[model samples]
Target: MTNLTIIQQSPDPEQVAERSRTRRSIADKIRGMGQNRIGALLLLLATVVAILWANFATASYEAFWETHLTIGVGDLQLDFTLHAIVNDALMAIFFFTVGLEVRREFAIGELTSWSRALVPVIAAVAGLALPALLFVLVAMGSGYKNAWGIVISTDTAFLVGALALIGPRVPGRLRVFLLALAVVDDIGALSIIAIVYTANFTPLPLAVAAVGLVGVYFTRYLPSGRGPVYATLSIIVWLAFLASGVHPTLAGVAIALLVPVYRPDRRDVEHALELARTFRQSPNSEYARAAANSLRESISINERLQSAYAPYVAYVILPLFALANAGVVLSPEVLQGAVVSSLTWGIVAGLVAGKLIGVFGSAALMKITGMGEFGPGLTLDRIAGGAALCGIGFTISLFIVDLAIDDPLAQNEARVGVLAASVIAFILATIIFRISDAMHTDVDPGQTLLRPVDPKRDHIFGSPDAPFTIVEYGDFQCGFCLKASGSIHEVYEELGDRLRYVWRHAPLTQYHPNALAGAEASEAASLQGRFFEFERGLFTDQEHQRPSDIVRLARDLGLDVDRFERDLTAPEVTGRVQDDMLDAEAMGITSVPTLFVNGRRHTGPYDAQSLIRALSEGPPEATPEPQHPGG
Candidate 1:
């Protein structure tokens, strides 16, 4: 019997309930981590703490990391300094998480589609190449040429945090662009670490590691509760890679690549549904409980494992990594010498000047050559700003520096360059983005904090838990919304269930007098499961929008006419409609049919292709600060 079938046959109610609760807890935790702010804050705090500890409590900082730790059985043994453990072991988890993310992107995210992936891919390449070239030019023959990889990596946490600090004027598309670019940049960085930084290769262990990786790939078909097996195999792979002289962290990437992505199979889903139907008939049966458990297991192992591990890596491992690696003893004399050193200047130049030229220049080239263009809502000015922000290469840069340069003094100087460049990049990027913001449309300061879509409350047309969500705040009577509705419909038709389309009323009471009534009508129809029908009808027949016509449309759509009429003026319905308007207004949405695809604003033309293309690349829209009437 299939594991899920066996699971569904479980007799224990307590076990089923407990498992459900655990799953929900994991889902909640994953959602929290996805928001990015808390982890960013933690990383920043860790870096600051490390810097302070390094400069002030130098001896203790050094001693704590130097404390050796050993683990083994009998003659087989392994030893590591605390710092090495943090760097090599803890960072493996971090890289594994990164690998999962990269795999996801490649498998199903923006990177899956060439149309969406090209710009970011080009930009990432340019971003990496330019930084390296600049570093070489600046540091060549200056005893720091080996450290060029330091400037090549982008600190995703810092870049994201910096963007968050910039607030809502930063278009959602820019975040996506930067994120995709960083992911590609990461792959490049890790590859460099694997190939360029390897000291030597032991053939036997390398072959054994390859075998372990192959074994790991086949484990996907293995039965459930094989955690110990997977964990043991992973460690074996890691240690083998270590002995083979490749950066052991690449083993994380190798393992992640092998983890099967969990797209629900049609046959499995159908079987689960059949089991669920049977469970409904015998609700109290052990078989029913087992069926529920089976359904849950149908979710991919990769997704479950990634969720379970992501928070630990982000909040704990990464922060510890920052604490261990970011610490550089910056004494006055050391600082003075670092400033004069070409290593510092090379890093600074590579990070700031190289990133700017590379990212912006490549993007401009794409636009000029008709090769590719930025995603919707990403302007060149904003891209320039993003390019500037790319210079904040803090974490990975330091990791590379540690691996590339052996001399302690030289490492400190490179660290100095990294620190100075990060500060400079943040400042310069802020100014550029702010200016871009001012030059563009007047943005409400409240739009900085983007709100999350609550599937529980929001009326979604597709799967409520779809990976990409498009929320439109539109007024039925607005002509622009009418046009936008057609494009939105086209997008829904093309993307199918992969896209969740949510409609929120943003009735322009000042202009469209019938908009409020229209919104209420839609909400009222929603009471009878006719929300989308009413919405589609309204958009299709713009002229038939009065209260009487809405009632007729609801009737035609087979909604309970009496109930629809009664609910049209219901307080809750009115409140729901009003709430949507309030949300739109708070977000500084001054116009009709403002769209947020996966939380990012779609500021491009209201065409089907543009809207579809934008949503295809995921980014959340900035949330506006909610305000009541004069509250």
Candidate 2:
């Protein structure tokens, strides 16, 4: 007998099932953490601990946060208490992350176009203005009318966390809208901090800060050492702002706004790929260094800095800020005083009532006047619930209290109101979402296509008037989507002209980094009348859809490579992909390779035989009533 015997054993089905279950569990946990639910819980725990410490061990709580620290080089030194360090220094990083997000949205995200941004921008303005107005109305005679700035901002971290805890049935569109609104709210709050609260008017230091900001802006053109340059300039700006007696945290925002943000350039991506190939073939230190640097340089500095700093800001900085700032003594005297304090009632009414009415009313008015439109499935009811959640203002509200009110007793009263309002907002939002979900219980959003297939806009692979239709919401980088592509090909072959197959971009960006790039590249290719061909190329090499790889595919298919590169970032191309994604979201299609036959969603295995059977069955019978409960 030969020593080498060919033998293969099939894997156990139970083991496979176990692995799948394990993967799903891990994914769910990761998703929860990414949504900042864990961070929010940590913040809440910190606030509770601070409150308990302040009540039971008031002297120790005060002593601990009051401990002073100093840092310096040579003759220059800076001294601050632990609480000031948390509020002034670490919080700058938090605000820097906020500025990065704002710049990104303006450059490439939801606010890239006026049409898309109108509703959120108007709503955010109203959300800010109305809260301040309400606060002033109630607190005008309380000797703290100037503290109206305290309620104009929403705490984004808590807002997102509250939504996660509430667990709305379909919160995708609503969450996006609220996040957009929060970004604007942050701008308003930062403006108030800079314009309304600054006490000193030192022109020399302000001029120095402006120079540092200009230096930071020019660092993007540097061929190397931009990171160190940015770091040096940012420090200078922070120190200048601190010396000027303007809020030092605003310097963080200034530096962050100056950081360049853009889509990845084709040339830069190709250069990186070339370096990567060299490193792979040579396996040398020099090539490795070059390849790493190239890859890092391909992504915009704004995005890179945001990724580097977001985790620290969310998990460490914000939690530490809460611990330092939320230590209000809730004694019987304070509670009784707060009950009669107009300042307390003003904060509650501003955040709770003003945020709800302002945000929801503006969005509703925009819709009614046809000034702007909401994303699919972002119903007025969901917007109302989201607006209620926006009332949970904690971080900035407390920070503003410290700045806007000097009296310890008044600060304590304001803290109580912020905490109480947050709790009330969470409860109110939960109730509203529950009611909305219950009212729409008869509608199953995931079972039907929200948008009809349009030949002029969609990527179609067969005759437009085909008797049978198959539409797929797919991600280019998904392994399952690649498999589904093969099955779709088989179906096309079997049905010939009878089948009209459509591909809609539903990139699961959380899992697939290159999926959105591939989607945009395909849309770009579609402009040259070769969408299906480029799509087939993407599926053929699903593992390598990098920017470089996409451009190479375009060249291989004899496309106008230059125009293709330009079109890859064209607003129309990006919008086309976004439209498909929004439609998929409206239908609650969270995963890839979701199929629809005729107009009804097809659920189950999407093999060629199964899909063909689905296509043969045709569209399901329509109910007499309309499907959209919100409509």
Candidate 3:
């Protein structure tokens, strides 16, 4: 009886619901923060404060940033002004996060293949070249034609934040496209900074920096103490770059590129799970430590470092950089000079007009030539708006102004241009997006399925000639979908051959980062004639749909793992998932676990009883005719 009493009772349903709601609220807040909206606002506020301080207390504003600080150990010493510290040291970390993103995207994210990479790559190159060209064309007489680098790169944080603030109807695909383009743009900018901007090249320190980068690369193999090893090596590389007269910030990029990034390994995750079970049963410190280490090791260090550093880079370093660098005395005389200044107008035109024309024009040309294509729902008008937003070149634009221009007054003019261009770009993008949304309202509003059931294309269970059909649009990471899966199983059991169930992909990527990947993985499995088997495995272990987990599931299902891996990124497989997403978008189906009975959308509860009742009602009257594949 005492042993029975020791057993844990099931949690109260109300408590469970309340806890779930709390978790969702927390998750939503975290997602919002991840979107960089708060960070962008803070950056804007910092710029305003800097401008006001520069205007009101010019002496103090300049003095505070210029105040010198020294650090030494024995005979060796280094000295820097407060401004240099912020620009050189703090900004290195910022660049490191960018490098991590570049590495991840190239490795496993959107830019993994040439086909997937072409659209952004072409657009980014044009975006970079056109801005610089326009700047040179405008600033030639200003004797700052060489300062073309100022407008060549987009501030991704601001771009994303601005897009969020604009509140586009469906921004997911466009956002992904813009981020990919930004990554390429960053690579180009970093290259220019290293080559074109580096006036002095000291071979010895650069050699030392290479050695340090090599050391950092090998640190991945270190069984333990990898973190400290990476930190020490990174510092050495940074100091080497500083000594070599190649910007120390590039050291961040170099080190980050060398860091290993990959999806979690199945073996490591299994080991972590085992340790977790042990810790749960024994409740001991040894098992706890082992479990934690295993869990950490399962995820690549690149991803871990990104999670650790991204928030600081976004919320703290960027805003601080703005506060340090954006100070400019905007007196009437200065403002009047800026109004007629060719250098100022050059930056304005290059960023606002050049970026808009370059990115959109290149993408349009690519689409016309069949060289590349935009993702579904990312129409030309939307692309134009995103390109306009890319013109918000605030952070890197100002950084380059300091590097390219020597005169304080000239820097002020350039700063004024960047500020004005960003504002104009924001307003322009907002108007464009609003107009685009107004022009492209959904026709059916998700009342009925957009695509009819094609047994050849869609994954289906039971007979194709079944009298009742239930189609579900779901994300693997959605808890509601997981619950609905249970209800769906019960309905399948009750109805059997009478019901033909279809599974469609509708991954809520903003909330569930792994959902799209999971959808693709299922499609990959479908290529091997094991779609339902993989689907069952995914629904059963919805919490573990990482790349490694998906691979392991494929192996467990007796599918050809190599083929499955190959198919996972195959164009057709990805396109299939994208098709479902496109249909979902067209039909205005935003939420997951959405069910369609026959050809009509099912509303209300999705329990087994409710689903069965809906299925029995048959197809609704005047349902939209499903189009043929590719129609």
lDDT of 1 at 521: 87
* Candidate 2 per-residue C-alpha lDDT over 252-315 given as tens digits, one digit per residue, 9 for 90 to 100: 8988888889987878888998999989999999999999999998899998998888778778
- TM-score of every model? 0.68, 0.86, 0.83
Q: Please give the CA lDDT of all the candidate structures.
A: 0.75, 0.83, 0.82
* lDDT of model 1, residue 74: 97
List runs of model 3 lying over 4 Å from the truth: 1-35, 441-445, 448-471, 475-502, 507-521, 536-557, 561-591, 596-600, 604-631
Model 3: lDDT equals: 0.82
Give the lowest summed-lDDT range of ten residues in model 1. Answer: 20-29
The true-versus-predicted C-alpha distance at residue 123 of model 1, in Å, is: 0.5
| Descending-lDDT candidate ranking | 2, 3, 1
Q: Which residue pairs clash within candidate 3?
A: none
Report the candidate with higher lDDT, 1 versus 2: 2
Instruction: Write model 1 residue lDDT over 155-203, tens digit each, in one string.
Output: 8877877787773353455676787888899899989988888887788
**Model 2 residue 583 lDDT?**
73
> Positional deviation of 70 in candidate 1, in angstroms?
1.0
